[model samples]
Target: MSSVGGGEECTVTEQQLLPPPPVPRTKMGCSWLFSLRTLAAGFSLILAVLFFHPSLHSFLVGSTDPNNPFLYVRNFHVWTRRHPQKAQDLSMGSRSALAATHFQSKQTYIIIHGFLGSSTDGWILSLKDALLNREDCNVISVNWSAGSTTAEYFLIQPRVRTVGAEVGQFLSFLEDTAGLYTYQVHVIGHSLGAHAAGFVGKTLNGTLPRITGLDPAGLSFHQADSADRLHHSDAVFVDVIHTHGCYTFLKMWEDCFGIDENLGDADFWPNGGERQPACEDGGDGATSVKDGSSCDHGMAYVLYIESIKYMPSSTHFLARQCPSWKHYNNRSCPCGHPVQYMGFNADPRAHGVFYLNTSRTAPYGLLDSDCSAGAFSLVQIIGLMMLSILLVLLLLLVGLVLIQQYFGLPILARVRARLYMEDLVWHGLGKSPSTHILNSDKAVDT
Candidate 1:
């Protein structure tokens, strides 16, 4: 039989030996991809919704049983009934508080709550009580559709202008009225509120001014250039007090809050503030520490009352605007520790000496929180600083070690093994039958 020619058509068996072509790749469509992305986004939304309403977390997850669907339907109704705000009163306050104030002059505090915080939650009543007691300070609590109460959210140009306008009106009111005291426009925010204060201070630049960042939030994010991150020159002194959990964490207070600059002879921190472990009765009713310390974010009111150190000048104290003090040649709080800015004309900066280094201390403070022993604790302060530095260093070393082990060591080991195996192969070349067999095969092919 004639064999198949070299370049000619294959025999019947040859055609059968060849594999069939792969099925044509389905021409892809955007529908499934689009649907997948949509599903992912929807899932993210669900997570957000669940976080917003933690109470409904368990009920929302579907169960396998047939009756579970009906059960969930019934439970959904029950959930709506139980938590009125979730179902009822949902968007009631969107624009409701927008114009709630009687006049535009009422300065808005816009207390931005911290992480996992709401206006109603986290020192709302206490903060309100403190500000309200001061009749001089007009307040408005800002609540947003999104829960993030950071300065990034609340201190936008629009909000800044709105707040500035309100403060301007209030300033006008103070000026127009005969008996009304002069209002310099201020804000006292805790944690995230501190960031909001910084944002507003930056936004206002000149008019809407004065912010007291009580322990200031986002310390870690802005530790290197805390002042730059919180550019609040508008306010007199961003009177900062480090007493919260974040402050003491890894010396964040010293690193971020400029406690070093403002501590003013207080080598230690929480000068005149409460000590945590010492506050055995705990934060419950123990508003202030026994040795008479201030805990949590107690800057303006708490520090001033206990006769803590007043900021040296505008260089450091953001809440207390010093240029105004210098330009006006007004010693608003010249001699008073934790100087109190009664109205516009106040200067306790030059007025007071560092309480830790000074003998002068008063019985009461600017705000409601106690200020008995408003001196920085040397032991606690020193320990925190050292601890924070050590922790940061330790973390850096650990990262380096991990890099060496996970990335460097494996590559080095592989290279060493390769070199060793190569040397062995080269040395054993004469003894290898496979190499000989390969040489013979090559000779035959040639």
Candidate 2:
């Protein structure tokens, strides 16, 4: 009886040790579902924070004060030939004195730098140097760094109009106080600054002389109206360089730069307007600046700077008028009369789109000399050599056939007879009749 009780106790203990029957699958599934739900919620929370952060920051710290110089006109500085290094600050109210002193009636070049750029950008300064070196003109480098230096493109985009209005006001002041005229003014701008230049031109009483837009920023301005963005009607003559204009898949940053549409009277599309030579690589457009991989966006200013530098050079930077890049590459487009040049030398009279090829490096201008002439010449030489060789081969073949037909058969028959006689003599076998007769005579003599 005691042994039976011990067995029962052991059985109970083993049953306990053997784990309770597996939990129901439904219960286990519910636990897993709960865990997944928690994870999803956490992920959603993170996404929400990321999405709202910029807006929240803008709402909290954005400037509201009307008198703030950084937000308005005080930040725009004018750099001329006389004061290349030192910038003359022209506010809305107090520009008459500065204009009288520095403004000239000659051609006035107002250069406005793009987003995250200042009057001191290398390209701007280089352009100023180039312009001053060539002609006696007033090259004013508009410094709106305070408005342009923001990381948020949206924040800075709206401020462009304010900067442009200030530029217009300054131009008006120059016109009233100094001897400056609207016709003498030439506004050159890059990216966002291009639109600002357009605004400046629009605000003037009459159209300005010209406006050269270097890869005008497409972001907010791409779909914007003529009054808001750069347009051909903004100036008497508007010229645009479209460097990085095509929409790139998976590259949202690139889409925000460079206007793809034809906003100017003459639009120059160099190398099909996207992925410039030597700049076909990786670059996050916002973070990686000036590393040349952004060459597609930066090439416009680079070409412009070179154009200004080499303006006086004899080589005419020729371009072919093409309906599209396909025609340009296919060589279907002819170099027509009333030749047009790209960049600063671009003829105002030249209407419609122009296409051209450029070297990847500096001195980007290509000479009017035909690019395909060398290739064509090489092909011609090769063709001529091939034709000469083919002719020679044909002549040799004809000569051999002629020799076979005229003389080879007779020679072959003579050689075969001589061989037969030699064989007969050597083998002491059957001989020709003449040889046999001769042998017979020899035997008789013997």
Candidate 2, residues 347-386, lDDT tens digits: the string is: 7877889888876554567775663322234556788899
Please give the CA lDDT of all the candidate structures.
Answer: 0.39, 0.73
Residue 377 lDDT in model 1? 47
Displacement of the residue 128 alpha carbon in candidate 1, Å = 1.5
Candidate 2 shows a clash count of 0
Error of 1 at 351 (Å): 8.7
Candidate 1 lDDT (Cα, whole model)?
0.39
Worst 10 residues of 1 by lDDT: 72-81
